[model samples]
Target: MKTKVLGLCAASLLICAAPVATFAQPVAPTPPPHVRESIYVPVRDGTKLAVNIYRPAENGRAATGKRPVIFVFTPYRARYRETDGKVVEAALNDQLALASLIRAGYVVAVADIRGKGASFGHRRGFQDRTEARDGYDLVEWLARRPFSDGKVGMIGCSYLGGTTFHTASTAPPSLKAVFIGASDLDKYDFVRAGGITAQFNTRPDEPPSVDLASLPVDGDEEGTQLRAAVAEHAANTPMAPLWYGMPNRDSVSPLTGNAFWQEAGVYAYMDAIKRAGIATYFWGNLKDEPTGQTLFGATNLGSKFLAGPGSHCVPPQGFDFTGEVVRYFDHYLKGVDNGIDREPRATYWLEGSNGYVRSDQLPGVESRPLPWFLTGGKAGRQLGAAPGVAGTAAFTVDYKLPPAEYFGFWPQPMDKHGLSFTSRPVTAPMTLVGFPVAHLTVTSTSPDADLFVYLDQIDAKGKAEVISFGRLKLSHRKLAEAPYKNFGLPWHSGLTKDLLPLAPGEKAAVSMTLTPVSRIVPAGARLRFTIAGADPRQRNLKDIQITPPPRIGVLHGGRDPSRIELPLAR
Candidate 1:
């Protein structure tokens, strides 16, 4: 009673200090310094989901009683294997909410999603929605347990945040709120953009420090054991060619028939969620999000974060959901009063020319267009297609090769063979909010072909920051096979289709989705789109048949018209 009263008084004090409700204004941006860790929490399923408990460890003493729980589900290793899950030898480092909530008298849990870390299960991304079920089960178990106050909230990055979407739609009774950063629900922008796969690109190598799920158990013959496992899984499944659940490499990819694709698509669940009246604040990386983020249009360049100089997007500060998460649970569970109702209700971060910008609606606001044309080549500043007529550029590289180094699922850099055409400084700053569509009428001598388009920001000092990029196979353009079947509506998934290949000098309207960005290319800086066969973040194989563009291209057709869309500040 006393804590609730004190919290209410504090909120009242804050309200009195402000002249009026500033819904458009940003949230309080600072946090106090106090954090602690708990070593364990076994879910109802007997799965000992490793949890790093965080709270005030001031003077090595913890508050005597149960605190509200903020649980984060991540695929990353929760703790080292040898610890019996009792000691958190280390914490999941990227998320900031974990640290901040502990200071606010809440118990923060970093739960390793099932199938990853020490948690036992065959690991694959969103596999059969097992993690989502784990989340619901954990909530009910925690609410009834003594260590918890029977209230739960969630937070995390990429896959961690992605899990929140699946679980959120289910509305676990114990789950009252969540802060999802860099995640998406649906195949909105995963693969088959414009109805084709632009793969065979190299993925960026994983940083040595970032944890990978398939680490081998210590043994005299580690390499052989690991290789055998990889081989077994690889052979058990040949899902990739079909883009379904394959083994090893693609168990987590969308192609996996696992629960991820089995469950109703994210789009299938939105109307249900709105009907349920659940309020969740969804967000995504301003930069790179491999799987779900862009699929639902949650984070695009314009309304999301745009690339910029000196902005090292390390340890994304975006997942830093603080005191607000606590208030959400309090309002729903303890009946404490917090101003969540009066705020924007939902928020997303935008890298405006001036720091971070906040908004109530993301897609509707930033999805508008800012069309620019590609002009000039190998020479001065030229971007997009020429005003009325379309334009083209051509470069050739080996098709049998991989673009860059590969690790886990992400590919390293094979960017050298890519071609870049840049625009001189914009008189002011420019922000791209949606996918920039490239209508390249192409041709190649090869019977089949592949292409990739990269949109980047060239800074004042000649450094390049990638905004958004996409890839596709020329054959899957119409999304068919020997046995043709037209799936549901094409535009709903929001994938830019890849079709119309090159045959010697033959041309076709080849579309590309410049991964959405919203960074301000500073004055005197440039915007460049590079066309190549691969990128560093995805696995790539050289599949290009070089015959170059016809020197001019134009807006072929589509609801978005043939052009790049920019999310400008209102």
Candidate 2:
């Protein structure tokens, strides 16, 4: 009887295992999305702009449906050739973001601006007027395509983002919305911030390489068309002479006889963009180069913004904004009833705080002016609430001082290249969340000088992290009434007519507004403000080599009380 019972138990176990094995069979994986490459869309000038269309896939083929289009216009190549010879889309490295929108049944299109990639024509200048007209034509052309539903939205970061603004300013009937990231609204402010030309901005465009050549469009299998297009780029205007030669906002370029800054900037086309009524969403990083433009777009263009603490065109780690992009497009393009429209206009990541903050407008709360006077004493240079005894601090400009890594998330030691003023340890946590203005009373031995101011937060362990910085050329120190709302910050017109060179040994009051920032300083942390004459990062082409490095003196206390005013959260 025991043997019979054991045999029955074994039979029951086998019966149960049969169903489990059947259920564990391998499942098929989802197919990759589909893309139609090398299509040329003609603009008004009969120039064919090369574009790659990505469509939602069904059973490994493009789905049959009329879908709203997400367009990207970029000077950067629309497609790139990898080392392995595989062709891929290069919409400002926003493939993941585009992939999400494509999966949600939207057709995505990326086009090379007039002269770049496989497109036919020559680039006149950076974001020239012709490019803006081309964008208008492309939007209308895309709307008429068989796969499109007569509605379109623009999206990109950096140069690509700038194109979106330019295109939207044309007010294409089909263009419904735009999502911009890390793009400059003011051209002069970016290329020549504070009247000092940014060296990196004047560098020549990257020459094509074997491992990184532009990918040929679909029918150009022999790459004949691509080569001809590249040859046309030989006539492209060199950036160095175009940017460095200007020196001022109203300066005309001898090459084109055009006021490049006045025509190229989105700020110049603000009225047109406002008339277009294109829904705008600007993604900005506090640590990026265009922080000021980000704030300007938010406050002036009726744009919703998401400002993070990442560098350049990057978003904060582990923070995916793909959903937010889709949600925004969904509401405007598809007329979805998602609550994104009802959400706050601004969302920002406040560093050293509880993480992200949401509010109807940027900053979320009122800010009070908190002034810190520069003082020098036995304890070294200090930043105090009250003015110290009258005195002047002198330092010779170090032209040969090696350029430090200008911007990053890491901490760097404060070098002796500049004068540093440190504040006492904070007794209570303080949140600084706006632009900072540095009012400096200075005298220079030379006729003119450059001033660079840096603000850093030093922790208990003595690690100093730069928070915000600004620079100005002394000759461009004349102030002017801002054409638009300037958030109450001082505005330097940076025009040739506004030049004010300093006389030797004559004191001049200079006030410069640093880039916007949002950081929380905990108790025991100290703040440091450094003033220097030269930053190799922003070298002017004409002034690269000065005959003699000038000595600069900062007159503090007494009548000329040099101070830095910060916007502290109330």
Candidate 3:
């Protein structure tokens, strides 16, 4: 659906669940001569979105003009300030995709989004009209220039991929097409997986990447470097802005560049964008692992459910994107019948001991929802399909200190923070593709506790691998919302809303969301979950301090039990 909106004003959540793999395309085309190397373009908003136009060089080293414009916009500064984009130029100049597009009679426009690098303006996100406006303004402006063919198309993966969605939604007159790879359609799905916080671990296992507190102030040298990022003014706070649907005010401090500003998850606005009617070429990661890709420097729609094998910024395994993504633009914007629209709607890599298996749609296979029950006892067992009894799962631990795996992956079959009890292996294969709800009755020695859940699969070979895990602070149990601010934006809450603090023998239901997946847990393979206080990979956010060390106690009742609901594809 094509609709118009101001551009680059708002930002959204990210999708981090993806697979890993890499593959480049076959380089055959050479660019034409005469295409100017670097040409800056201005957007209507006073934000100059920097663009480098490349000519169709089938065999030449430099440019020759007059070709269709293929545009790639990014929030990350396109080039370094002083390096003269040398590093970016050297790396991307010969990139198979860009070079091929040039060779195919296309003038490529690689621009840095406003407020970053060469471009100047406030740093808004794709979820806003500013980005769309910036893109549309760039294309319309470029089309009239002597070098452009009056048509523009887009291509990129991860954050760049996300931009395609943003651009497509704002289908402008000059905007013809886009090639989206490994990205989530909604911001919430990308940012919050299955209704929980993200554990972005691929590249940085250290201090979370969006550390606003570490950002330089407005006058500091470091802040000067981010002058482009600083908005000319603040927008709304803790609320989405008016037209662009983003919160414009600085609910949080900007010294950290408003890390919480991107929380307007894209999922909530899909209906509006869908009504905009932007067609896209959606690509998933390697095996839909759990970490999705967004270009390293760009902002992504944080989602784990939609993630595949790709990394946060790039694909897990690179692709012959030159053929696929470029061809998409060539056909739609260039008026060439490249037969791209005739290809399968989706493509993916299968992880069954075999390589990738190309397919038509993303779900790839039929999957159904599975429900299990948790009896109130130490074991946190699963009650298959049987009607759930009014029961509960209970446990106790050393609440003085929490375990690490706060809410990501774990070592063994599951997180070992609390206690676990498993049922016999499934008699048949099973797969779950939805959130595993944790209806638990638990409490802590200190009036608060974080219930961690690690859902896993034990293969026929007798090895356990973690599929997904989650956690919640007890104080947040009765609250309708989360009370902390990462850059001042409130985090999503439903699990915490239901959390009930535990005293000895205290019981309550706190639902913990697990990762979604399409895998074959063979009959001999057992579906398991470990309800602990933490995993080794997580950083405890709740500053729970206990003066005198005491054990964390929680009890489970088999009749009215706590259970995890699994989605079955078989």
lDDT by residue (1-570, candidate 1, tens digit) is 011111111221111111111132123233334454433355565655545565555576666676677777766555443324333322323234454556556676666665455344443443235566777776666666566777777766555666666666666777776655555444423533433333321223232223332333334124344333333222222223433222111134444444333252454455544554444654444445342243342332112221211121223343323455556556655567676655442233334333333334442243444556555434542564344334445556434444443322322223455555566678865544434556555555454455666666677787775666666555444432211111111222222243333456555555554554545456787777666653443332323234542122222222322344344433
Tens digits of lDDT, candidate 3, 195-282: 3233431122122122112223223445443443334313212211221122121133243244233443343344444453444455
Q: Rate the local accuracy (lDDT) of all candidates.
A: 0.46, 0.77, 0.47
What's the TM for model 2?
Answer: 0.91
**What lDDT is reached at residue 569 by model 2?**
61
Candidate with best lDDT: 2
Give stretches of model 1 more than 4 Å off. Answer: 1-66, 81-94, 191-265, 271-276, 290-340, 345-352, 363-368, 376-381, 384-392, 398-416, 431-434, 478-506, 540-570
TM-score against native, each model? 0.66, 0.91, 0.65
Off by over 4 Å in 2: 1-32, 91-96, 210-212, 403-414, 539-543
Model 3 scores a TM of 0.65
Q: Choose 2 or 3, whichever is better by TM-score.
A: 2
Residue-level lDDT tens digits of model 2 in 1-570: 001111111221111111111122112223237656568777888887888888887887789989999998877777877778665565323332676787778888889888777788887888878999999998998899899999999998778888888898888999999998877778887778888875435655667552127777788878888888777777777777788778899999987788988988877788887887889988877877676777777677878888866766664443457788888999999999999988777777666643555567566235667999999878788999988888889888877655544442222333467888899999987778789899999999888888888888899998887788888988888888877776878889998888998887899999998877777787899999998877756544246646688788998888769999988865
